[model samples]
Target: MAAAGPGQHPGNRARLIARFGPMAGPWHDALPTLVDGLARRWGLDVGEAGGGGTSRVYRCRRDGDHEGVAAAVWLKLTPDPVVATQEAEALSAWSATPSVVRLLDSDLRVGALLLAGVEPGTRVRESGWRTADVARLLADLRTAPRTRTPLLPPLGERITFMYDMAARRGTHDPEVLAHGRAAALGLAGTGPADGLVHGDLHPGNVLVGPGYRLVAIDPRPTFGDPDFDAVDWAIDGATDEVALRRRIAELAALVPGMSAARVLAWCRATAPLTTGAPAFLVTPAGLRG
Candidate 1:
C-alpha cells in the first residue's frame, strides 16, 4: 500500500497527550532511550513510518545486510500495554497464514516486534484498490486455521458501555449505540464454520500488489464466524447516508449468508465504539481483552 504521508491523519504525540495527559518524568526520560536501545539490539536503522491516533509505526532496516536482505520491519509504539500485547499475539497467530505478514520476533514485556514486511503496494486508500482485491485478501485471511484462543468480549458489553456513556456524559448518541447493541447480540451467537478471523478487515488494512494480490497487515485475530468480520470495511469512509448504505450492501454481498441490513446495524453500532477513542471509554482490543 502507499506509505502514509507525513503530518496526515492524527499525530502520535498529540494522541498520547490527549489520552494520558502530559507525559510523566520517568516515561518521558525513558522512551527515546528505550527505542534507541531496541534499535541497536535488533540491528535496525530506524526512520519514520506513517501512523494514526493511537500508535506510531517506524520503518526499520537491519544493518550490514543489503537492502534486499535487510528486512523492512515496522515498530508500532503505544502507551497502552494491553493494546500492544493484543496486537503482538494477534499478529503471531495470523503469521501462520501464508498471505499474512510473519511475526519474526516479539517482546510482550516491551511491546516490540520484528515482522516480515510485504513489498510496497497500494493501500486501500490509494487509487489502485478494487473490490476484487479486497475480496481475495479477505478470502485468504479467512483460510487461516483456528485455535482455542480466548475470544474477545462480546459486542454487547461494548454497546452497553456506549449507551451508558451517552446517558452519563450527555455526549453519547442513543440511536447509534442502540443499533450497535442489537447487532452485537445478534452476532454473539454466530460465526464462520471454523477458522481464524482478521477482526479488523478494512481497505486501509489491505495491501494490494502486482495483479492485485492481497496481503493483510494490522490484524486483530479471533476465533469466530468469518462473516462477522466484514463490518469494518463496510463502514469505512462512509460520510453520507447513501454512500454508507451502498458500501454496507457491497460488503455484505461479499460474505454469503450475511445481509446488508445486519452488517449496517452492526457497523452503525460499533464504529463509534471502535474508533480512536480513549480506552477507558471503549474496548480497544476487541475479543482478545
Candidate 2:
C-alpha cells in the first residue's frame, strides 16, 4: 500500500506535533533536507514512503544496485532522537538474533535509521500469525544483556504508562476498574528485569521476512519477564477463554523459560489496562481493591 509522503498524509502533522511538540519543531520543519542529507550520507536511492505513527519509513536501495541485485532497505526516521538512540542500543544487543531486523546504520543526530527491509514485507496482521512463530520471535528476544542498561527499562513501566493514559482518557470499562485495575497495578510492580523484550510486539509490528520467517520491528524495548511480551499475542483476535487459553498454552510450551500461568496472569492483569478487553477476561478473582 502506497502512503502519502510526509506533510501530505492527513492528520499526521497534527499527530506529530501532538506527539513530540515544539521540542522537535526544528526537525519537523527540516524533513526534506534531512531526507536528502540521509540519502547522500548513506549512499541510498530513496524510493517510496511507508510506515506510520511516530516514524516515517522510506523504501530505498543502495547507490548503484538494481531491483534484483542488491537487497532493498528502509530509512526509518523518528521525531524523537531519543527513541532512535534507545532503539539503536536495543537492536545492537540483539544483532545476532535473526528474528530482528539488522540495523545497518543509524544517524541518531537526525533521528534516522537505515534498516534492512524484509522480503515480502507482509505484515503478520495481513498474513496471520501462528503461535509457534510468535513464540519463536519471543524466545529469540530473550537474550539478556550482560549488564542491565537503562536503555531497556522494565516492562512494567510501559504498562504503567499505558494504564495512566487509559485512566486519563476515562476509557476504562467499569467492570475492568472494579476487577482488573488492582491486578494491573500489581502486575506492573512484579518481577526482576530478567531479559530483553520487544515491549510492544503487537501483530502490526511484525512482518514476514526472508525464508518465510517472522521478523520483529519497531520495538518498544523493555526488560523483565519475557512473558509480558506474550500478552498481546495471546489476546489478539481472541474473544473467548478457549481461544486465549489455547494461545497461552501454545506460546508457553514453545517460549523458553515461560509458563502458561505467568502469561495468563499477565493477560488478566493487563486486559483492563487496554481499552478493548475480550469478552472472556472476566476479571480475575480476589483482584478487588
Candidate 3:
C-alpha cells in the first residue's frame, strides 16, 4: 500500500488546516503514511479512517492474540503530542477498574494510542441513555484511578478553554457564557478529587462496550471535582427544569459522594456551552441563572 495522506479525504485536510492552521497541514498530509507506519509498528490491520474531535481515528485489528486485549481495536492519532501523552496517562489511570475504554498501547511521541474496541460501539445517547447506568459508571470512575497523574490540568483550565472557544465561535450568549465560565471556575476551585475528571464527558464520549457496559472515551482530563463530569448527563435531553432536577437527583443519589448541589452548579455554569438547554440555563426550582 502507498502513503495516501489526508489528500485521500478531501475535507479532512481542510478541516485540520482550519482548526490547527498551517502547522497541521504537514501532519494531515503525512497522516496516511504515519498510519501505515503505525500499522507496521503495532501489528495492526488498519481499516477506514474516521472523522471526529481533534484526532484522526481508525478502526483496526491486532495481527496476534494478546491476553485480555481484543483483536478488534481502535487507533487515535492526534497532532498535539502533549495531548496524546496526557491522554495516555489519563487512560492508564482510569484502566484499573476501567470504566473507560481499555488502553492497549500508545506511542506518545507520535500522538497515537491503540485502544480496545467496544463490541457494539453504540453511543449511550443514541441508545437512549439511562441514569442508572451513568451513575454506575460515574461511581466506578471515582475508584478507577490506581495511578496518580500530577501533570494533568485542573477543571478550571478546561472550563476556560470551553468558554474561550465559544467566544471565538460567537454563537453562545455572551452574558450566559461569561456567567457559566465564572461559576464553573468557582466549582472547580473546590471539590473532591477522588478521580480524574473526564473533562469532555458528554453523551458522544460514552459508548456501549461488551456486556452492555457503558465505557467512556476521549477524556480531556482534569484533576479537580469529579461532580463536574456529571453535568452533561444531568443536562442530557432534559428540556425542562423538572426533568433536569430529577436526573440530577437520581445521579447524585446513585453515585456515592456525588452532591446534587454541586452537579446543579456545574450544569448552570456550563449551560451556555450546551446552548442554554431552555434559555434559563438549566434552572432548578426558583433559582435561575
Candidate 4:
C-alpha cells in the first residue's frame, strides 16, 4: 500500500466536513493535537496518512524499542467513537490471527489504534490471485476463535436495518430488499454462528502479509453465521451472472457451511443495500450514527 500523504487521506477532510456538517468541525480541529498526542504516547514517528472515507490512517515508525528492532505500524484514527471501540475490541479479539491484521495497541477514548503493518503490502486484488485463493483465505478467517464482543449487531438485526434503510432511501428496487430479507432470515435459521465475521471482506480489504499468505484489514467484526463472511466475494467487483455463479460455487466448496444457494441469496440482498447513494455506502463503514 502507498503511504498516505500528510494527515489522513487526501481530500478526506473536505469529505468529512461535507458529510458531517457542524459536528465535524470539532473532529477536524482535534486531529492535529490527537495525532501529536498519540505519537508521543506511543513513541511513534507519524509519517504519511491515507485511508478511505471514515478515518485518517498513517504509516508510523516506533521511536524506541529496547526489546528489538523498532517496527513499522499503521496508525488509524476514526471519527466515530462506536467504530473506534468496535475496531479495537475486534482486533483484540482477533489477537494477531493470521487471517487479519494484528492490533499492536489502541486508545479508544481518543479513537486511535496502532496496527501491525503488512510488509510487502500487496492487495489481493492487485496480486493476480484467483477466486479460489481468496475464498480459502476468507474461510480460514472464519475459523478463528469466536470472540464474544458485544459491540457488533447480530447478523439478523443488521439485515433488517439494511432493508429499512433501503426503504427509507427509495434508491433500490423494493423486491431486492424483500428477497434479501427472506434470504437473510433463511440463512440466519440455517447457518451456524461459528465465529467472528469480517462484515466487509471484499478484495480491496484483503492484503498479502509478511507471515501470512493473506491477511484481511478493515473488519466490521460482527457475530453471525460464518457463511455471512463469505458473501462479499460474489458481488465485490466486476462480475456478471455467469461469473457470479461460478464464484459462488467456488466459494461454497472452499468455505465450509456455505452453499451456492445461500451465497446467491446474500448477494441478491446485499448488493443493492450497499451500492447506492453516498449515504448508503457510508452507512456500513460505521459513519452512520
| TM-score against native, each model | 0.70, 0.87, 0.90, 0.80
In lDDT terms, which candidate is top?
Answer: 3
Select the stronger candidate by TM-score from 3 and 4: 3
Native-structure RMSD, model 1: 7.4
Whichever of 1 and 2 has more lDDT, that candidate is 2
Q: Could you report the Cα RMSD, in angstroms, for every candidate shown?
A: 7.4, 3.4, 2.9, 6.1
lDDT of 4 by residue, 35-138 (tens): 88778878877787777756778888886468767788989987777778887776777674577788888888877789987878888777756776777676
Question: What is candidate 4's TM-score against the reference?
Answer: 0.80
Which 10-residue window in model 3 sums to the lowest lDDT?
280-289
- Show where candidate 1 strays beyond 4 Å: 1-11, 17-29, 64-68, 151-172, 190-195, 235-289
Query: Which tens-of-lDDT digit does each residue in 46-94 have in candidate 3?
Result: 7777866478888887776556453888889888887888888888887
Instruction: Please give the RMSD of candidate 2 to the true structure.
Output: 3.4
* Best-performing candidate as measured by TM-score: 3
- Model 1, span 48-147: residue lDDT tens: 6555645556777765565457667776665656556766666666666556766776665765666666666557667545555565566666555555
Candidate 1 weakest ten by summed lDDT? 280-289
Candidate 2 lDDT score at position 103 = 98
Show where candidate 4 strays beyond 4 Å. Answer: 1-5, 8-11, 17-21, 160-171, 174-182, 236-242, 274-289
